[model samples]
Target: MKAGKLAALGAALLIGAAPAWAEAPSAAPGAARIADTATDEARLMALFRDDARREDALDPLALIYRGTAPDPAALRRLFTDSQLRAQRGSVIQSLALLRRIDRRRLGAERQISYDVFLAAKREEAEWLRPDSIALTAVRPFNHFGGLHIEFPSLMAKDGAVKYEDSADYRTNLALIRAFPTVLDNAVARFRQGLASGVVESRLTTANMIAQIDALLAQSPEQSPFYSPVREFSAGIAASEQPALRAAYGAAIRDEVLPAYRRLRAFLNDEYLPAAREQVGIAAMKGGPGLYRRYAGRQTTLPVEPEVIHQLGLAEVARIQTGMDQVKRELGYGGTLKSFFDVIRTDPRYHPKTREELARGFAEAARQVDALVPQYFSRLPKTRLAIEPYPAYREKFEAGGSYNQGAPDGSRPGVFFYNTFDLPSRFLTGITTLYLHEGAPGHHFQISLAQEDASLPDFQRFGGNNAYVEGWALYAETLGYPMGFYKDPLQHWGTLDDEMLRAMRLVVDTGLHAKGWSREQAIDYMLANSGMGKSDATAEVERYIAWPGQALSYKIGALTIQRLRKKAETALGPRFDIRAFHDQVLGSGALPLPILEAKIDRWIAARKAG
Candidate 1:
């Protein structure tokens, strides 16, 4: 879901490769160049804030998401090769500046910042490699997590962009007008992929083409892009609304829809024919190495695909035992596979209507909110809102996803649940899904960091998957102490959700690493858990479109669980669950190793006290 790109001459600074800049020069023992720990730390923090501002300047959408006003001029920047080079250069320079700080001289808090910033820059450096860019930048968008899908949602009335005043509407109109250029640049990138034999999978290509077709089928008035002008904010004069409406309608009709048609035509005519039949990145020119980098980046460790695949298989077997226990408690006489079938097809286990589904999640949130303080000491100030995926995007979306709100709490963080194919949606996963995507999961972790002004900008707003998603997955386990899974069916639901993550470990690796077909991945999912066919298909396709991301959930949960167990054992009677949680989340999302080290320090401090 996250995206970023560098040059061949700078290959020495690639991830895992040591760059010369990292070794801060040692001052002579007799020299007067003493380390100013406070001054250095202040300088470092200032640099972090400055660089974050620079990053926000380049990415107006980021500013919009962060609740900061954006410059209209920056909004027109297209997705071009020159832009990619500039981003890479900025990262390389930032990393150089970061390494100049003597990390050991700083206090513990800044040291954590120093390490996290350095690691993120290194990861960015690797991703920007010319070869990596060729494989990735060339395929700028896909069916899932692509800008084509995300932009519309972001521009919606209830979405991230502000709609308070005439200028706000004008800024949004500029964004809408600039979209065609972005889409055209994507076509250009796809052509580059085709010429270089780094094309996307045929399956994803078809899905993307279908998505574009769906957008083109709608009139400008019905389009999500035009929704903003349908009603102007109270701040806008009534007389001004007509001109804004006409401008929006004309932009969508003349520019946006035609651009979608051009993209769709190119995919149908040129790109689809040239797309790789194999879904895994391994089939492409530099796919294997790219997958390895993705695996490392997603997991935040240099773990091999086979190792992750084996871990997934072991987890699937273990979670199946839990599912069997739930089945026995339910007094089901059938085998686990049959039980899965029953859950999949039974109307009682599925939602009857979209409103019913919404109510289910709403009730789940209400229950979890009451119980949150018992487990977590600090909560997110930003309110959480539950909504269904817009009609345009639900088909390609996962069952649920979290979109963070403004750090200042202007916009409420949204947990979007897919209501497409309502009959196929399960009620059992509601509580578990809410726990992961809402409170004590993403909302808690993201909001807490951004709200704390004490941390550097990178630490507050930036994060890796293993920590962010891992924390959410681990949060799902808290349902036990909170007592929401008392029902036999709900217990099975949590296990099934856990099984989904476990299956991702298997299915993702199987698809990308072991030459498993899409059908094979979907079949593997169906045989293991109670996921419906349609949901299973979507999950498999998600992994295909974005490799190694699924692997993060289980891997991250395991790391956090292991650390908790270690803390419990070491501190014995002194162990405080709330305090342990505070320690885990207090520093924001970290690489797995950095997180472990942070926890170890906390345990040591507890023992000494």
Candidate 2:
């Protein structure tokens, strides 16, 4: 669900420049115990600020997202071997610096900041370890992930990259000119992957090959990288417009196109055929351990694959029961298997046109938007825009996804509803889908977090996937409290979406850990849920391409729900839904353990009061 192209890769939203001293004046942590208390405190904060700046400076994409111009060379580069080594060394140095900070002397909020900082640095250092860094930093892309998908998206007028002025055009043109270098870096990384015997699945490689083939089929004027040149604002001089356009167009033809052509040849002739046929990562060398690392990073929890698999199975059963009851209410006397077949074939449950699909999402958003004030005290200033995936990218996109808006609320957050192969899309899932991806789901959690200047930049722009995705998953249930889902079908939509998440737990672990085949995973989804074969196949492939990520949704939602129940049980009448929500949204995203601790303290504070 946390999908982005190149921009997504820059999601290392660090603890931004330390909270202003004037805002939260407190004694330096552990300062009293040290000979130079004040000096230690100043050193700690200065380190935090310096590290954040270093990362931003190195990341051209992050700077672009922050609405600032970066060195044009940033567009041409991602990671060189030397830069990667330097970055690793920096993380190691930062970790050492962090360890010297005294936690006991910090104020209440600063203590939380310290803990968050420690966990982030520790995680960074762990990933930087020779074994971990080599495995991950190489193979910088799957068929779905690499800059191949992102570069095109970012260059569009609507994307994160800006092109308002002549200088902006030149900056982008510089990036385009440097794209050959970017592709070379990717090829070098892929070669390292090939050498290490750490290649992606053939499925992933084949799809990547096809992506390049599709793009290469386009005309130079129509190239993804050439999109920005087509739209010239008044900021660009009329005489200079044609020249900039031709330059970018030729860059795509001479520079960008050939880079992908080489990539296509390498993948088609070498990598794909040499890649492992097995869908699971466990079959690769040192795969079992590597898979665990992925799982840990995605979930931020130490729970094993088997534990998640079992939890998924239980949740799947619970959701199935709900589905059966709803089926019974609808007076369908058939078994659940028959029900699945019925919905799949039933035209009424399928949208006839893409416009209808978009309209349905619009209505769902309107209903949720109207009821927003009743459920929470704070709402996002950023508006939510519903749109379909662009034609070129639609085939590969899942049913729908949400992208974060700009922090200042100028650009609206988008819920991209996939309209490809409309017959394969389900109408029953719309209400729940909107709740999960639109108004109260990603749009709220991400927008509110980014908009809040009170939180550090790291908390706003980056955090754990579980908290973000889990909050979205939990938002699906809010449809019930908001007085939607009254229709039996809409109620079933919620169950279907819940079942989708539950199935992910089983299928993700099953594919990666239990050695389940692609066919077997798709079949299981079809049997257990309302998914069409096409949708199920795409979802399974997503898990195969990106391992361990699928497990976060249900695991995260369940944790949040359990904590909410605990708070509700203890607070009774004192539990203000508004305040509890504000607290959760107020701090942005947190690791699960940190989130649990924060909630426990809140409960204790409420009890004391």
Candidate 3:
């Protein structure tokens, strides 16, 4: 039930540069075999280092444009068409590989090693924050360079990476320089309550401050961040890169720390205090216009907000009617609402342990895979595994999400479930979420695109909220009537999930655009759907923080449904679900307009044949 403007937060977290590296040959059998040899360890290290450098690389143009308004003419010259295309291309491959590794390592006994790898990453990031390398490369005045903050540390204990004391000083120095601008923008955005207020939930907002406070509270030497800087400095020393290392230290001490102090002071004094207690976008100024833009971006469609609002209202009506039909079919005379009530209170959906909850999802994955060939011809090269969310982050997640694999088969896709509160991991939504996050949803779409090496990297990896999420939401319905949910309870569960998305439209718009208070949104959810108080509250807060994003789920699902129906109507007897799926996924991900064009082309080709 995330309610924050996730789009803004999501974009903010992504920072780094790519170290230019010579291209490696394809992942042929020979190359893989060589990778496994003891001698190849050096090669692996070199590759990892190169990958590390690549992560921090920034577009020089983006750096230049920061703070200054974009000069369309000047900006045009700063980036070539090819460079932008290549950057997008690289994103696809990088994300694919990243997802691949997570999927493969999930649940293995040696999974601790993956933690070590991540720990190493934390350390490296710390080094890059304030070290000579970061200081020289990262423009202190710009947000694009230097380091980026992340959710939290996933690793709990000492691992392969030795912990050192002096890391935060170096990193904080680099990070703080940009803090003034970032915090100022956040504050300004919050102040401008137009198109939904930009305020976040006090709890989550507090968490943001806490994250910074934790760092600031630490001694420069004893900080979790400082360890990385010291090691990086030592590494450079051993390599006799004394000049580079010294230069990095001076930049961190001089330019970065002051900026951090400024942001910290602002959060404590201004932003956090003004944070709203309300969760949803409702009651905010001009919520409707904001939600409309959110809807447009989420769907990648130009559909008007009023039209979408009406569509959502209609869908809710339609779905409720269908639920009644289901009840009548089962000879249950009670109202459709009663059936929903019965299912919510039922114990059959409850799982006893974290493992069972996860296994339930894994089982669904298996079930979907078994049925894959029946409706879809193409499969992703990337494999997906179901895993519990990492402890640090799970507390905040209501639903599971897909962790895409690396494109080069260096990683596997992962579906991370929030197994913290078992009851909230409602059984009814399990199958739908699996399909949405795994199987023919995110897992299939993301990995398939990544696997397509010929596509531009950005096209594969680059995301449009509407296309990716829409495809997955659409996938939820593909197997719904195929007897996937044989049990009445399970069948109800499927509908419940569908209704949840449909409801998102009403509540999302209601809160963000209609001036419905947070309490109003929560009550609406509780009354219309079987959402628990906790889940409902979290969700409402998420919507407030992130205006219009909630609308994407149902909107995307509906678009895909319409498209599939188009295919069905056009092809009739020749229609193949699997073929249709393959075609849809084969193009990787594109904006809805591009997706429509591609699909139309496919339809034409099939008709011609």
Candidate 4:
């Protein structure tokens, strides 16, 4: 739903930094190491490890991102322009080194790694260009995608940043102290965007203003950023607690809150006024090219926006027909549009209270967990916890989302379901939502990759939208095999959710590439699916905020589903479901082409066996 780069920015803005670049690694694959002396396997592994370490070193906030201790300089450095260039230079160098590897000498498994690394390098190479960086660099933060929204989650008491001891509190205090600089930089970036005609949409700017206002409404102790102070670890002595609390209070009042106020004022006084009156990216300068670039990176396929738009239309129609069939089967007298209205309006379909919604997700989680063992063999050892979205973020967030844990399984993955608007949150979608965002969806794909020590960190932690989101979307279809979508209503829920993804393909391209107005896009979604106005609006705004991202869900899911069909057709009875899954998830998050090649090879081997 969001860009990974923004997560880094969230931490980057939190921590301090330097612009130093270290020398290249000692061993150069293929150029220096021969296959005779060392297997291609060992060389590639070393190459990958070196690449990861180099990246981690260059990123002072990498520790914050990976749930490790903050760097001593983390609080000192924001994403200074020089530092951004330094990071890009590292990627380019890594790309050059990676291409030096001899693919011919690599074994089949190593070949996959080679392809992934090469593809990543090439992709990163595209983003390094002045125009590419300028597209996002000028507009560094957005209401939906960047540090402004994500900072709370990173700073929350039970959030990604761990609070274990006094040192941890101090690190956070330093991050808090450093925020004004980041916000000032954000203002500067917004000014750059204004100068370059790359400003965000007016709608986006306004929403961001509201987001800031919400934060400002919270008292110092209640501020999401102040949570660490409120819940000081029992490990700390009571004698020291008051001082720490006061320090946190002072920082939030003087530093953090004031920074947010500055950001809010900038959004209101300058940025919002300059925001584009037009809704679509196509309306902005160089937006068409930028949208195309995003479409490529997001899907990791050579798909044109026109092709995506048409594909979306076809998918929308097909899914609608399926929904019609379900409606007919369910003996509904009304037309499909009427049924959609019913679906939206029915009191029974909507939850009565936030607790009911939370409990609903909890119950669905348990039921989905029961079905996981039969769907595929492996279950993530990393526990999945279902909870409501934090109060500050719920208004802007989707119905649900997943936050992955550390690879080592020391921390459990969290599935945050929005219980904000209880009545608008339909009960019908609960089961499918859990299946998509929880078990066999994000938790399984993300946690399994991290937990697999055999895989390199790149495979374990790194991900592309297609494989990651696609696998989760594909997981939604498993409801039938798992026997959960049996009730025609629940079945409709699956279709609605699936239709949401399908419609995303149409609506995303429509809004971003095809020049569909926000209202136009929202209307198209409401007509096509059972989603209420609120979710539809938020989603349309999301596509606007993060262009081409919505395409990945349906596009990726279809690719995986198509590959499954191919495997099932090729091996027939020999196509073991568990084995097929193992092959897919075992490789970590791969690009569609790489995943297709790997799955085809697996199918061939299975047939021979």
Model 1: which residue pairs collide? 5-128, 6-128
| lDDT of candidate 1 over 382-404, digit per residue (tens) | 99999998888899888999999
Sorted by lDDT (best first), the order is 1, 4, 2, 3
Which runs in model 2 stand beyond 4 Å of their true positions?
1-45, 67-69
Which is the leading candidate under TM-score? 1
Q: For candidate 1, give the lDDT of residue 23.
A: 32
Q: Candidate 1, which segments miss by more than 4 Å at Cα?
A: 1-38
Q: Model 4 segments beyond 4 Å from truth?
A: 1-39, 60-62, 72-76
> How accurate locally is residue 579 in candidate 2, as Cα lDDT from 0 to 100?
80
What is the C-alpha lDDT profile of model 2 across 434-484, one tens digit per residue?
888887889999998899886667777878878888899988988888867
Model 2's TM-score against the true structure: 0.92
* Candidate 3 C-alpha lDDT tens digits along 1-609: 112112222231123332223122245223343345353333333334444334324342222211111222322222233433444444433332332343253442123223223323332333233222222121111111112122012111111122232342233333323334443443333344222334444544565555555555654444333334445533234443344345444543553344456655755676567656654434333334445545655665555555556667777777787777666665679876666566556566566677777777878878888888788777888767777865534555556777666566545777877777666657767788888889888988888877876543344555566678878888888766656766665666667678777777888777666667878988877776665566777677666656677778776565566667778889888888787777667655655555554566778878889
C-alpha TM-score for every candidate = 0.94, 0.92, 0.63, 0.92
Rank all candidate structures by their TM-score, best first, as comma-separated numbers: 1, 4, 2, 3
- Name the TM-score of candidate 4: 0.92
Q: Which lDDT tens digits does candidate 4 get at residues 1-609?
A: 212121221122212211222223534333364323376667677778777876776665556657875554543445568657766766755654654567898888778888777777666656666777678888877878578777677777887777888888887777767777777788887888888888888998899899888888989888887888787788877887899899989988888888888889888998887888988888998999888878878987767787778877877888899899888877887899999898889898898988888888888887887767776788888988888887888889898999887666767899888877776788888888988889889999999988888887788888899889999999998989888878887899999999999888888888888778999999999999998888988888888889889989987888788778888888888878888899989888998878877887898788788
Name the better of 2 and 3 by lDDT: 2
